[model samples]
Target chain A: MLVDPRATVADMLRARGISRRGFMKFCATTASLMALAPSMTPKVAEALQKARRTSVIWLPFQECTGCKESLTRAGGPTLENLIFDAISLDYSETLMAAAGHQAEEAMKNAIRENWGNYLLLVDGSLPVDVPEYSVIGGVSNLEMLKEVAAGAKAVVAIGTCSAFGGLPAARPNPTGARPISDVVKDKPLINVPGCPPMPIAITSVLVHYLTFGTLPELDHLNRPKSFFGQTIHDRCYRRPFYERGQFAESFDDEGAKAGWCLFKVGCKGPTTYNGCATYKWNLGASWPVESGHGCLGCSEPNFWDWQGFYNPLSTTQWGGYAQIGAAAAAGAAAGAVAALAARRKQRPVGQDVQEEGK
Target chain B: MPFEALDPRDAGRLEALTATASGAHGPDPEACESVRGRVDSGNVPLLLNEVRYALERLLDDGTTHAIDVRAIPLGPGEEDRLLDALGRGELRAEFDSLGRSEVQECAYPGVWCVTHYNEAGHVAGRFLEVTFTPALLASPPEDVRTGLERLAAELAP
Candidate 1:
């Protein structure tokens, strides 16, 4: 295929003077992020090394360019982003120097060149009712999406706006915005939804595809299960506080100042799913909850339609009776399974066998 | 005879293997390190199945869960072997809480190991806690409040 000139992530890392240990560490970290066993580290490293350059087209639509900005300006570039950037990204409306007709022409050319083999990354949501709500190079956002998605190997809805009809699709969606899934149904789509999403999650999805040549396992929402497998509340450092019923009543109260759980002060961590609790923003400096603010659940669908961000989470919004019972059951099940497995492992000898004809 | 006479050196190795099972005397340190150097456990299939099951549970609710290893007695060097199989992840935290604690995350998310030391600095308790959140950071809020209150009282008349 006449894809853009590309280099394997290994080659890029080597060229950048990353040693074998450094590269292995990066692979190990990636494996962990994807929740793969340590045994899979070498496999991940090898797969990444031999991965072919994938062509990606990042399409921005009727939303703020925050997704693009967050990923491109990820606090500090790591090996993950290095591999992501290493891909043959022939067209990115935000990143490309070409403008107007030239940019559109370049994308069409790239699409023609890589046809049916390139990745389609859409960052913004499309407005269906008002075609003029968003236009790129004279083509409406919805039309542009259909055209590009037709030839894509897989369509990745990059942010909440594109994946779940975010801010643009909030209550009374004026422009009548719709998510990419609502538009492109045939193509395999992966949602990396967040307000701006986690840079690592975005990179993980791309690397996962590059290494395995298939989309990473996704959740019901079509978000990568590795990143969305755990709710922020389940893993937050302040969860013990929540278990102990210690909640920050106000933004500046002692609980807040003491970094207690933000469940009371509009914290949606309990219900929101992402790796923010583990992989914080700004290179592990802090996440919203760590900063003493409640999670806004920006990555979830129709997040803007949810209760206000700063208001305390309603009992229904939090893990109420049913969810709590389920969580407890899961915990109990885990304990029982572990105990049974342990007992079986410990007492493996068959010493009580009786002989028939002694 | 089916059994061949063992060499004295071979006998030592056999004894070491048996000792490994008994846990009365640990495996040879050099032998343990040598096994660590091996890329994969000869018993990959079993470990793979076990770890996979644990991983499935982890992905179910996105809630952090722990599989306490205290009850699961391990043979000498088995802990290291398991951790090796699990793979050390990005986060490695060291702190002095009850004597000292070194907590390490496994390559797979939601798996962690914490080794606590006594006041004399000997290894006191070792736990392989599997959870979405690292166990070291899970201090109760009441403890924090009491500690804060005590500190305040200490400073007051």
Candidate 2:
């Protein structure tokens, strides 16, 4: 169904049977996710309610379509997707039924009409060296990007490919893949990268842009600091296990079975930063580690080339050994038992002090 | 008897060298006692906003929150500012768990300032909390009930 570009977001939400309470609830959640004080919820809701429909032109280049799944999974009916859907998506070749000349014309029309105001969303990497490697309509990925980006208010690099040369730019990269930042350096660029970014994470960026009329505060990687400021290890549920020097040696060992830390199995949670711990995936469903798989460090730069997915990450730089040295030598099977035993034996700290307070 | 206006040329220098340092009138500037006490704390505004939000959440949804003050960089006087802004409520407690802990309810209802000190008595951890009761003092009611039931059974036998 075609939505009018002129309608305020509030009008659209009302049309969809969404109540103010629901919208406000989502805003509160978003504000919390953004680490904003609760007072900001009203502002978030007001911005979303009254904001004009923004024109978004999504350009997919050398890539797989995994990102779409994250969008569809979490973004289907929630306010996050509703806000995203409320935006006037003038062109997305993969999503739009229009093909051939019709598709190209839609792209041109959107650019011409909303010049300097529309947002350009790019997923996948651009085949810079070999234009012929990937093309939409006889125009190379780089050529098309340069043309469309020229008229954009901001550019959002939607996946690892567009931020850091993702899988397509992996070893012996055949397509001469390059990230969006490498190509479009002038515009206000935001990198919302992951294997396929969490849908809420992606939508929050759009909401932030609409609310403030500018990109959200970004980290060193130009990704939103609210989401990417801390590594997965920092927020991981298994972090306490890691601190105590307990680790799963293999995929199905006792440590693994008991939900010990995955560091020994090459879990990239420590170095990788993403909202997998906080937001999880698949409609607040479990992420990999919860289900017994280690983190692949999918959100990081050049993660594909980081080599062994199952190999343990070197912790010499982080002083992992020195921190947990006394217990580091013990294997997970022995460590878990020993730690539990030690915890029981350790003197109860400040019991007498607590009695006084009581 | 009468006030005569000073000549313009003399007016500029009439105050004299000593007068300039001490001011033309009133007490000498240097004689005024030096200021003391914290004027403002930088972190107060941020932490106050956090407290406000936490209060709203607690009232609206019964959500509990913990604010680690140490995790946030405190300005020179911000901690004092936060303390002043928070004021003080009914609850106050101190503990030596692991090291030492001081928990106090702030001026705002349900808001608390919890500071943990290491063995050296220096603050090792500090937090602002918003909740019906401090987390450290809370124990599970269900667990307590179960233990009580078991104890009653033991006494009966």
Tens digit of per-residue lDDT, candidate 2, span B32-86:
1111111222245766787788789899999888764533433223455667877
Question: How far off is residue A149 in model 1, in Å?
Answer: 0.6
lDDT agreement with native, every candidate: 0.66, 0.68
The stretch of ten residues in a row with the least summed lDDT in candidate 2 chain A is: A344-353
User: In angstroms, how far off is B118's CA in candidate 2?
Assistant: 46
Question: What does candidate 2's lDDT look like per residue over A277-315, in tens digits?
Answer: 656664433467754568898878777766468776555
How would you class the docking of model 1?
A: incorrect
Residues forming the 10-long window of minimal summed lDDT in candidate 2 chain B: B30-39
Query: Candidate 1: where are CA atoms >4 Å away?
Result: A1-7, A15-19, A316-358, B1-157
